[model samples]
Each structure stands twice: as C-alpha cells, then as structure tokens.
Target: MKEKFALGTALLVASTVPVFGQQYRAGSSDTMDQNNQQDTQRGSCCTSCCDECCPPKDPCAKCAQLWPSCGPDWIITPGAGPCTADGCDFFVTAEFLYWAVRQDHLGFAVTLPEPETTSVGEISHPDWRMELGFKVGIGWLTCIDGWDLYLNYTWLRPRTKNETASSKEGFFLQDYFLFGFFGPPGDFTLDNETAKWKLDFNVLDLEWGRNFYISKCLHLRPHFGLKGTWQEQKYDITANATQPRGSTQFFDTITGSADLKNDYWGIGPRAGLDTAWHFSRCFSVVGEFAITALWGRFDSRAKATQTLFDGSVTPAEETTTTIGTGSFKTEFHSVKPVMEFFLGFRWEDWWCCDEYYTGFDIGWEVQWWGGQNQFAFLPTETRWGDLGFHGLTVRARFQF
Candidate 1:
C-alpha cells in the first residue's frame, strides 16, 4: 500500500508539471488569475478590471485542477511573486535562460587574430665614441612567423674629448672633403693647443634567416649574412724636446682618436638568442644576444696637405703663394667578430593588439678584429681604438 501511494504521488506531480509554467489566455486583458469572480463579471472590457469584481480565468487552471500542488506554488499572480522563477528544483530558472541565449552566446565567437612576426632589426650602442651616442637598425621578415629577410643600417657618433699637441706643425688635419678629394692647400696650424677628438662608426647588414622558438619563453636565431662597416677616429699627442729651434720630426701623437679611417665588406654566419617572460596579458620583458663573424678587407686612405709660403719669391714679391701636396692610401685584409645584447619591455596588441608592437631597449655592442695594425703608407699603429659601446633603442613594428 505504501509503494502504491508513492507511485500515485509521482504520477500526480508529473501530470501537473506543464501547468506550473507561465500562461496567457486569449483576449483576456488580465495578466494573472484572481480568486474573486466579481471583477471578471464587472469588466471584460479593459485590463484594469478590479480583482473583486472581474477575476479573469486562471491560465494555469486546467492543469492545476488535475494537480493542485502546481497552482499557488509555481504560478504567480503578477504582483505577488518575484519576476523570476526561484523556489523550484530540477526546472530551468529565468535568469539562466536569459544569460544562456544572450551574453554567453556572443562572447564565444569573437577571438583575437594570430600574432605577426616582422623582419626588422633595431639595435643601439651606448659608448659609440666619447659623446654618449646611439645606433638604430630595422628590416623585414619573410614567410613563417619569426623568420626574416632583411637589409639593415646603423649610425653612431661618439663623444669627443680635448687633445693636446707639442707644436703647431705637429697638428695634422686631413684635407679630405665631402667628395673624398683634397681640400684647400693649407698646413694645419694649431697654436700649440688642444682640440676635441672625433670618432664615428657605421654599418649596413643584409641578412636572411629564421628565429626559432626553443620554448614558449625562449628564441634562438642562427643567420648567414653580409656586412659592411666604416669607422673613423682622431687623436693628438706631444713629444719631448729634440730640435733645432724648429725641426721636422716624426713622433707618435695621441689625438684622443684611435684610427683615422677604415672600411670593409664582410661575409659570415651570425647567431643569436632571445628570451622573453610574459607575466600577464599586457606586459612582458624581453632580451637578446647576437654574434656575427665577418671576414673582409678594408681599403683606407689618409692625406695631409701642407702649405708653406713660397721662400723663393722675388724681391718684394706680390701676393704670397703656397706649395706642395702629400697624401697616402692603404688596403688590408681583416676579420671582425661582433657581439650585441639588449633588454627591454614589449607592449602587446596596442593598436588592435595583434597588428603591431613597440619596444625600448638598453644595450651594448663590442667588435674585435684580427688584422695588421699598420700597412704600407698607413700610420704604423692606427688601426684600432675602443671597440665597445652601449646605448638605448626605441622602435615600432607592424606584423603581416
């Protein structure tokens, strides 16, 4: 008998389930059914019929009549219940239904595009000479996310310091102009003074290679490329007494400059590694270390023109005249190894995030060469100077 009773209860609950939901009656201006019939009889004309005079037919009445538990428990009379389905179990809720169809459905279909890698290189050297200068590089990336095929150029002008000379005649200044030709005939006249030493270096590199991701946080790049470099240095020096009041002498002078000129074309393989750590969606720290082995010959030239008043001028000679032209050229084979490093922060997808990136780096570079210190017609010890530098870099890029 107990089992039979339980079975009957289950059947009743199941049968009344459909009536437990929201209902609408045709042409009945009422929102819900009221217990009083007086309102229903008084006004079938408008929706404001009072409950006491014109109670409308119950929308849930048919099922409620079969299963009485569904009438007041699950159905609402508009003003008496909350706007949502709350006090039920195993049935869908109003809040759940609205969210499943609206918010959740839209967010899942929108995704950010894949990130693009570029073929540009940007680098810097701090102590380029003496003035605290910098260098910049950029290029283009080819097929594959991190691979690049590039042409790059860099510039640097280091700081200068004053240099002293023993005699004005010893103050040697080149007579080369913009066209690499001799300047006006004139001896470098330094009234036994000191002048600033100037230093400059520049390069252009054409490289092709791929940057491989060793892990999510690390990248390694091994490249083969060609490089061309140009370098210039200047300095002054003083020599101890040894003269006929005025004598032509050859003594080493430190102009504060290392080498006067150098130019070379090199071909070799380059390798590098970069590391990155992403802490969040919008911030990351990155660093890189690169090396290039370049072998090439540098053809260089230096000239100093001296203008001496014409001593054999006629008695009371007219306007004065100058004479004599001197110059020298040199060529040598050299191999240079270059090293570079950087540390910076990367901002993600700033302009639509995945379309481009910006970075600021502080780093340094060192170049070591294997070659002769001097050559024919070239100063015996003018081929090397400070080969290390450090600086900062700021860059912007677009990914394809």
Candidate 2:
C-alpha cells in the first residue's frame, strides 16, 4: 500500500515537471522510442533488470517498482525499440475483412447462336461475394536486433449462390474437361442452365521479422515465414434441353447435372517486405508483397448425370433419349507458388503517457494461387485453373 502511494506521487510530479532539450526522434514526433539517448554500446544484451527501479535512462526509473519478471541486477541493456523500461514487449492484433473472389471458373456454358441473332456465344457467369471474416494474431518482441516473432490465422467461408441463364435455341458447354465427359464436342445443347459455387478458405502464417528505419521517412520490416493453406472449392451446374426432332416428328427432352470439387492443402516458405512511409507520427502509407511456394495434395472429383424424356407432340409415338451418369475421383501431390500484394494507409498513436500502443490500418489486398483450380474427369484429362482473391482489410492492434 505504501509503495503504491509513493508511485502515484511520483507520476503526478513527473508529468508536470518541465524537462528541457528532450531529444526528438530523427524523422517524426513519435518513433516508438523511449525519451532518452540511445546507449553507446548498441545491441548489447541486458544481463539483469533494475533492482532500484531507476529508469533505464531517466530519473523516473529512480521511483522504481519491484520487477516481477526481471533479472538479478537492476541495470538493463539499452536499445531503441518497443520493449523499454516503461513498456512494450508484446502485442495482440485483430482485423476485419470484406473480400470477394474472381469468377473466372464459375461460368460453365455459352449461349448458342441462333439463325438471326448476334449472340456470339455469350458466357454464363455467377457472382460470388463474401460478407465478413476475422484474422487474429499475437507477437513477442525479442529485443535482440529489434527482431520479433508472430503467428496469425484467417478463416472465411463464402456464401453459396445460384445464377441462371436460358435460351430458346440451346446452350453449348465447353468441350474440355468442363463437360467433355458426357457428350461429343459442339453436339450437346441445353434449353436452360444454372450455376452454383461455394468456397472455404483457411490460412495460417508464422513469421520472424524486424522493423527498422531505412531512411528518415521510410521504415520497413523484412520477414520470412511459413504459410499453410487449406482451401476447397465446389461448383455445380444443371441444364435442360427440349428440341423438336424434325425427322421423327417428336420432341427430344434432356435434363442433366454436373458437380466438381477441388480440395487441397499445402504448406511452404513465404517471404515478404512491409514498407511504411511515415507522413507524420499519426499517419503513414504502407504496402506489402509476399510469395510462397506450396507443396500440397489435391483431391478432386467430377460427376455428371443426364436423362432423356423424349415424346411425340401427339403422344402417339414416343422415344426416350437417355444419357449416362459418369463420375471420377483422383488425388495427386504437386508444388505451386502463390503471390500476394497489398497497399493501405495507417493511423496510430499512444496514450497513457506512452505506456501502451494502439494502431489502425485500412487497406486493399490481393492474392493469386497458381493452378489452384485442378479439375479432372478421367485419369488422362486435367484442367488447370488459377484462383485469385481481392478484398478490403481493416486492422486494429494494441501493444504493451
């Protein structure tokens, strides 16, 4: 009780005391640096903690408190970083994400051209969007050459939706593995079509980095990390066809459905650079670029079913045009590379006499996975598709 009383007394006096010629940060009003000159012998490891509570370089440390987690001696080795006699050894962060994926592979068919129409094979595309997800992380400051270690996880499951398109004549499916399993090229047609898509994305990252100044106005953090991803994609399409057979005076009615799923997980080394151009203590512009080479396995499946309900207009004569049901599953291991980029603006500040830290960042991020859309229907047939993501990200961080 007595110690608390004295500590409160010291703080009240310290805040009001006027100290002259305080050294300012070289570039900005705030550099996350303590209010003192850096030690001459830089990067020297602190062998002990202060017993007397004298500040690392201030008279404030003199009104010291008992160190709960400190070394045998009182003196701490000096460095300019987050971890100071006052505070800043570790941090926690959270982020808000609103993102969407590209719709390249979502389209399955093209509108067939009729006798007098300019329909040059219009592609059917589905719109996919995401509402919200979360990214959370923790970090530890080693205070060794300003190095830090951190880990984070992200999870997002996009909403599923169906998009439909129709034609009076018919729709044509691409001959490649997209629909090659059921019919011959350019012969199969549909009266109406609908497409649906769903995706589950998971990512984990562990990194080691150090933030330091490259120039008066520029700061950078270069990090090397391992990233792991477990991603799954499901796509479905259904089509119906009703055409009159002039040769037989009957109607050829066909209905079919196709489903494809690509599930994979990979882990590999990732490296990146985080750059910050500080316009002032409270605001900065930031950008990042990272690449990872992932070694992973892909378990893919493709199945299709088609049925014929052929009948005459008069119901006097009838013939059924039936199509078969086919399915195939395969799993393989391969290596692929992913590249991601981001740019944003940041606002940060400290309160409570700089004992704690808080920051906010808003930005845009993009990611591309090479050959992520691996779809196959037969042992010999394979289709490679690239997956990409673009989104808005907002981050909030607190440190002590």
Candidate 3:
C-alpha cells in the first residue's frame, strides 16, 4: 500500500511539471499575465539582475505604423515648451533646389533645311538655345490633429541666360573665319534674323497639404492645392545690320552698344498633387507631378533713338533715326507640367519651445512647358513650340 501511494504522488508531481515548464497558456491574456508576473517577481527578487537580463523593446515598430513621431533617439521638444509624444507644434524649414537645365527659345516656325549650301544665310537659322538654372524657397507649416498644411514662397533664376546678344553679322563673321574668307565686321550684312533674348521668371506659391501616418515610423503624404506663379521675360529684336540704323529697339545707334530690352509679365494659377513616403523618423522620399496653367500679356516697348541724317548732302549719309513703339495685349497660356523626384532629411526640433519647427529639403526636377503667346498670328492660334526647362530648387520652412 505504501509503495502504491508513493507511485500516485510521483505521478501527480510529474503531471504538474509540464504546467510549471509552460508558465502560460496559448491565449494572449494568459501570456500577458505570465509576463506581468515574471516582471514583478524579477523586479522584487533581482532588481540589478532584471535590467541586465531583459532589455527594453519597442512594442510598436512596423511599416505603416500610426504616430510616426514615436521612435528611438528622437527629440520631441528641445526648447522651452510642454512635452508631448508627438512633436513640436511650431516648425520651420529652409530648402534649396539645384538642377541641370536644358532649354531653348520658343521662336518662329523653322523652314525645312534647303539642300546643303555653303552660305550661312542659305542654311536655316533656327533659334535653338541651351542653359542651366536653379531656384530657392522658404516655407512654413501648421499641424492640426493628424493633418499638416504647408505655405511656401520660391525664387528661381536662370544662372546662364542672364542676358543674350546676337547679330547676323556675328554668325557671318564666325563662318567667314572658319571657312578662311575673313573680312571686316561691316563688310557683310544680315537680314530677317531675330536677336537672342534673356528668358527667365520668378514664382510665388501657397499650398495646403495633408499627411496620414500608417506606422510608428512610416507615413504617406498625399496632397493637392493651388499655386500662384509669375514670370518676367526681356529680349531685343534688331532691324539694323551692324548697328542700330533703322530703329533703337536692339542697340544704341550712336555708340554701337547693342543693349536693348523689351519686358513683360506673366501671372497664372497651378493645380496638382504630390505623394511622399517617409522612412524612419526624419528621412523621406517624395515624387511629384503637377500641371500649371497661366495667363498674362506681352507688349512692345524699347529705348529712344537719335534723329535721322540727310545722306544726299553729307559724305556720311546717316538717315534720320526715329523710334516707334507698339503695344500688343498678349495673353500667354500653357499646360506647364513638371516632374520631380526628391530625397529629404528632416530635423524636427522647435528652437524656443513648441512654438515652431524648422527643416531643409533639396532635390532634382525636370519641366516641360508649352502654350500660346501673343506673338501668335491669330488670337486662338495657341500653338507654341514644345519648349522644355529643367533645374534644381532649395527651400526652407517654419511650422506653426
């Protein structure tokens, strides 16, 4: 009987061994209870050993996590402000865009190439120009709930095409020297040619955007808004051969300085959408495509000229120089389309408190814009050359 009782007790102890080894069941509640009990016992029995034995872990770290600002080594509010798990309430950013641009003049129609000829005049003269440019901008941001809105102002300028000057004789002189038919500047005359002009513009825009978080460290930014853009273009058209003899629209008739300008302004509205992908807490990549439609005018005005000369009486028969101005109300419109890919790094810290935040972004961009100009023959002949422009831009932002 004693042996049989000892055997039964051993069997009961053996059964309880499995339960002790498991520590918890297969359910989440059981697991949580077990973890809590272990944590408590470890804290009570081995305070120093507990920290060394179990390291801290982020319970929620995954792609598409909600609350992107909750990550390791991230500073929420560095300055004097109320601390929050999210981020600073106010922020600013400074960004710059640097790009390599390939562009040309939107000139008149090109006559098909005549059979190969030796004369520069017989060879077609199409205005095909090339240049490079860059732009800079500053912006501010306001966040409410889970949505973020942005307002930015950008200043862009073409570094290469600040100004351009070309005369028919200049080309002739070049050809003559290359072909070994060297001659003086006035010895040759050119006709029906347009002067090289400086083509550039500046843009100001206000946009509202919204971002949604998918994960603790990752989010998606999809936004659409209206942007206001402006432009300024100044160029010259010459009527004289070597100097300003007939008009002063291209150069000074007396000093031989060919510095004439015709200026115009363009204003319009642009509407489009962009998407951004955030990786980690302070790094992101964005892809944007937008269509811009603009309206403005172009007028014909230029510098004054000197009086004409009587060629019949004097040996140097300088004709009386009279200047005439023509004003044409031009409406310029285009489906200005742009594509840009950018990788940005962000520093999310408000300097003086949760009052504001600041950051900087830069990247590459390509643009293709074409529309109708007042120079068109008809009011509706909205066919301008398929012109292309490319460059880079940098910008800064302050968020509130």
Candidate 4:
C-alpha cells in the first residue's frame, strides 16, 4: 500500500510542472506584444511634432491656403502712398515725338507768257521733312468719383528750303503781272539767274480734358482745346543782265525778294476713347482714338521788294527798291481726327517705391484735318491735309 501511494504523488507533481511551464511561456509573449504597441504609438507622436515644426515645401500654395479670403481684386504694393491703394490719384507725363507734315496746297505755281496763251512754266515749294516735337501733361482726380481733369500742351516746328535756276534769250514775261515790277517789259537776253525758296511751320496746342473711367483699365475722355499755327515762306530771285551800251533799258541787274505768311487760330471740342489691356503684372497694350471740331480764322499777308542796278548811270551802280503789299484772309470751320496705338512694357514699384513707375511704348499715330485753308490758293477756296508719326516713347510717372 505504501509503494502505491508514493507513485501516485510523483505522477501528480509531474502534471503540475507541465501546467506551470505553459503559463510562463504565454506571459512572455503578452509582454513582448505590449512593448511593440507602446513603441509604435511613441513613433507616431514624434512624426506629427516634426511635421508641425518644419516649413511647407511650396510657398505660393501655402500663402493661398493661409489667406483664402484675399481675392484677385486685392492689390498689394511694397510701398506707401495713395498709389499703393487702388488707382493713381495725381500724375504727370512727358512725351517725345516725331512726325511728318503733309499739306499739298502749300505750293506756288509760276507761268510764262506765250504768244497766244500763257503756259505753266515751273512750280516751287518747300518739301516737308520729318520734325521733332514734345508734349507735357498733368492730371488731378476731381471731387467727382471716377472723374479726372487733365491739361496738356504740345509744340512742333518744321522747316525746308529749295533753290532753282533758269535762263532765256528773249523777253522774259511773267504770267503773274506783279513780277513785271522787277524789270523792264521789253525783249532782252538774260543769263545766270538763281531763285531761292524757304518755308517754316510752327504748331501749338493746349487742351483741357475730363475723363470718365469705365473700369480700372478703360476710360473715355472728352476735351476742349485751343490750337494755333504759323507758316512763313520767302522767295528770292537774282539775275545778271548783259545789255547794249546805248540800250534804252533802265537797269543792268535785278534782284527781287517776296515774303508770305499765314497765321491760324482755333478753338474746339474733342472726344476720345482710351483703353489698356494687361497680360501680366508689368506689361500691357494701350490704344486711343480722338476727334475734334474747330471753328477758326486764317490770316495771310504778302510783301515784295526789288532792287535794280544801272551801271550806265552816274556812280556806275544804281539801286532801286519797290514794295508790293497785300492781304488775303479767310474764316472757316474744320474737323480733325487723331489715332494712337501702342504696345507697352511697364515696371512697377520703380525707384523702390510704389508711387513711382516707368513705362516704354512703341507704336504708330496719324492725324487728319479738313478745310485747312492754305495761303497758296484763293481766299474763297479751302484745302485738306494729313500728318503721321511712328516711333518709341518713354514715360515716367509719379502717383500720389
């Protein structure tokens, strides 16, 4: 009986040892799994903290995301002034110009007397050349909203000269009877003579314009203006005469000079449309078209003088002067049309200030006038003319 009881006790101990070993293995696996879970949670927290401290990769995207309230209409400038806000309140501009003048009626016609009828001989006039000009303007924002007042002045001058010569063996009769005062009306042989022609033109303009803005980039301006123009022309002739010793003529040499002038003044109303299209922050295209109607007066004057030399007279040289004076004037109404177009590149925030800006433009322009009333024709007749220009323009602006 004692042997059987000891064997039973040994069996029970062996069974208990196996059960304890299984429990220990299970507890070790649970501890390892808990440690791995804690490590993963701590790593996730560190990653989130790093993300918050570092800057974003794209700045534009970040700014847009942060300032979603500011729309495209918002203007942000780096300087301070009224210009930094929305639009230019006050401004000034200076323009350099080059233009060509086209006035065909500003020429003179000369005719020689014929046996039966007078025939046209020669035509004389000064050729119009390209001329330089300038303009200056100032503007102010008025009390009326989107309305501005501006004043501008422009000036230009062009000049030309021509020389011609002719000779004849018989009586030289001028179809215009006024030229007969320079010499005797009889037949004579003439040699070596020269004629000179000179002309000068001047133009001035002053205008006051009121602008109504349709938007930030478009506007219509109607204007009232004053215009003045002056033209001066001179013609001179010199000749040497060979006459017989006993000839009955009074003079051996002749010289004549004639001067002509035309002055014009007008007051008018003008209207224009101005437009700008911006394709970038600093570049744009601009265009303008205008028309004006003017009521004006033209005043003309002509004068002539002649000197005659008679070698056969007392002192071997004689000088005589003759004067011809006349006035031809007219009063008329006219219309003028002008067009301008340009492609411009602008630099904003110039001189490190938003109130300062600079721009450059290259383009073409044309102007036409009707009923110009030239001095070359009869007082009752009128003429038309046109002018054109094309070149580069530079502009600097101060906004306040």
Q: How does model 3 fare in lDDT?
A: 0.40
Off by over 4 Å in 2: 1-85, 116-119, 169-179, 184-189, 245-252, 310-323, 377-379
- lDDT per residue for candidate 1 within 1-400, as digits (tens), equals 9999999999999987766542334224253344234433333221221222323335443212111112333433211110112111111111000000000000001111123133332221111132333334445543243355656666655544443333323122221121122232223322232333344556776666554433323334456576667665432221121112134332211111112334455666666665545443234466776677767676665553332332223435423322333456677676667776667775433222112323333333334433412322234434342255444455444332
Give the alpha carbon lDDT tens digit for every residue of 255-369 in model 2: 7778888899999999999887766545679899999999999999988887777666666566655568888899989999999898999876555545666788999988898
Ranking by lDDT: 2, 4, 3, 1
Model 3 lDDT at residue 124: 26
Q: List the residue pairs that clash in candidate 4.
A: none
> Model 2 TM-score?
0.72
Model 4 C-alpha lDDT per residue in residues 12-84, reported as the tens digit of each score: 9999998999998889989868755653443221122112233322322212211111112233311111132
The model with the greater lDDT, 1 or 2, is: 2
Q: How many residue pairs clash in each candidate at the backbone level?
A: 32, 9, 43, 0
lDDT of 1 at 80: 10
Q: Report lDDT (CA) for all predictions.
A: 0.38, 0.69, 0.40, 0.47
Give RMSD (Å) of candidate 2 vs. truth: 12.5
Write down the TM-score for model 4: 0.56
Each prediction's RMSD to truth: 25.4, 12.5, 12.2, 18.9
User: Which stretches in model 4 have alpha-carbon errors above 4 Å?
Assistant: 1-88, 109-123, 142-144, 162-253, 311-315, 319-353, 376-394
Model 1, global lDDT: 0.38
